[model samples]
Target: MPSRHPAEVGYGHVVESYVTRTYGGLPRCLVLNGGRFLGLRWWHTTRFTLHLLNDAAAITDEELEALLGYEWRSRLTAAWLIGVDRRERFRARIGALLLASEVCYSGSAYCFALARFGTHADAEILAAYLDHYLPRTDLHYDQPAALGALLRLDAVLGTHHSDRFTEPDGLWDQWVKGVGRLGYPSYIPTEQRRWADVQCEFANDWSRP
Candidate 1:
């Protein structure tokens, strides 16, 4: 694996401090940080920062715009954090990024986030991603996250396409198997497991009404 970025390391420490002081619990902080623990991996820290921003109760448009300008991960997370309530200001940018073929894991993250907080059109965008984009990509670690996103989308919309890309077993279960077949262990971080559990709960609730 490549070395962690200095900024990522610093961000990890900062997030750890926040968890220790502000949240008073690592679990809460990790949830807000999108299942990232106190690690120095650049991608993990990046996701954590985006989740932190997303959980913030209030963010000025200027602050969000600055975040949107930071990097692809930041931009996608910002788009998700902004949610449907503030869709008008950032929808075009998010759409453009989603359509950009060069955007990678962040794009997948955006798809997951959008499915939860986006409009119908955004859901269509995610369906397009599932139908067209995901198959062509050579995803490794993030495949489960993307699969989880699709599962969430299916849960909400009652449309089933997760099995189309994964195994016949089930959503999360099959993704774990698929990842194992790809030579990666099916070990999700503790925080992500919690997140996945919550998604499963939410899916169940949505299926009710």
Candidate 2:
């Protein structure tokens, strides 16, 4: 293993810190150092994720699995680590978490990981998530995030899995029913904001093929 930098984070520490963490954050912001990144400052509670990307080389699958068992922020960080490493084995676990929707704010990270995998199987997982959740308009899950990831995979692989969902009167159309009204509490969740931001981060900083 490479020598651990004094400032680099460890996977074990990340898995344990979720017990008292706050402010769910995206991995893109975490590494890119933006305003909304979860672990920007190490002195504060949010720094559990700081230097996590730098520590990716030493991360183990078991460590990631442990992280998956925690709350939303840890799961989000774990998923980001998994996606960044392209650890294909965790695809099913990530899909399961996205489907379970046990908590809020982490669904987008799961979607980002699925998109990172960019395989037909990942598309299927995203499709399955859409099939199960989009119809439940009563619950606001990661519908937009899953839909966006599916569309991205379909475009890359030239498949039509998302066509049915995107068609008129489809689940997505139904889910989008409450947008634009002045007093309506819910609105159509757009994936572009989170999806595009994370995608750009991976493409630009992959250290290239």
Candidate 3:
């Protein structure tokens, strides 16, 4: 992580100014322009730009869609960078993306975002995704990410549905067994580890009164 925030850097300042001037200070513009700015193309600078957008008080649907269209890695990173307060506004849109058959790592990113910022309805959507993907033997990385989201949701909301399909414990057990059976590959382990970390962080944050 960059010690200096995005606003502290010259390129960051320039991007912010452009967004304020050209887009009436919408945070979404900052996100879009940050990606377009030649000076901010480096990984660290881009991460800073995402931090800037994530810190925004509000982001419009149009803005988010634009962000989602960014490079796959950046799009996934943006999903995690977004603040929880703004998650609800993007939930339906993110859910739509998650359900799309074509999405890959970015879809998993949407799952992680929902775990951090979703409501009960959002949880239901994640559960549906988990139910849809968990059974396939072909091996998909997003399944673990989806399971992680469902687990986090259960931790935040308390156990609502006790059945195997919806319950966190059951889902977790299934994921573990599935992983064991399939054998851990490089990408699979990475995603599973990330999911665990995300779940822990979400649980900690939600525990705060």
Q: What clash pairs does model 2 have?
A: none
Please list the C-alpha lDDT of all candidates, in the order they appear.
0.47, 0.64, 0.53
How far in Å is the alpha carbon of 45 misplaced in model 1? 17
TM-score of each: 0.50, 0.71, 0.56
Model number with the top TM-score: 2
Off by over 4 Å in 3: 1-55, 58-60, 81-85, 161-163, 166-209
Number of colliding residue pairs in model 2 = 0
Instruction: Please give the lDDT score for candidate 2.
Output: 0.64
lDDT of 3 by residue, 1-209 (tens): 11233333322333233233332233434433233322334444444444444444354444444455544543554564443344577777677667763544666667767776746876798778767766654556576667666655666688653247534546545655666676754224335545545443533343212
- The digit string of per-residue lDDT tens for model 1 on 50-92 reads 4444454355555555544445445544554554234455655
Candidate 1 off by > 4 Å: 1-57, 76-80, 84-92, 98-109, 161-163, 166-182, 186-209
Best by lDDT: 2
Candidate 2, residue 206: lDDT: 47
Model 3 whole-model lDDT (C-alpha atoms): 0.53
How many Å off is the CA of 155 in candidate 1?
Answer: 1.9
Query: What would the per-residue lDDT of candidate 2 be over residues 120-177, giving only the tens digit for each residue?
Result: 9998998899899877766666777787778777777899888898887777777767
Clashing pairs in 3: none
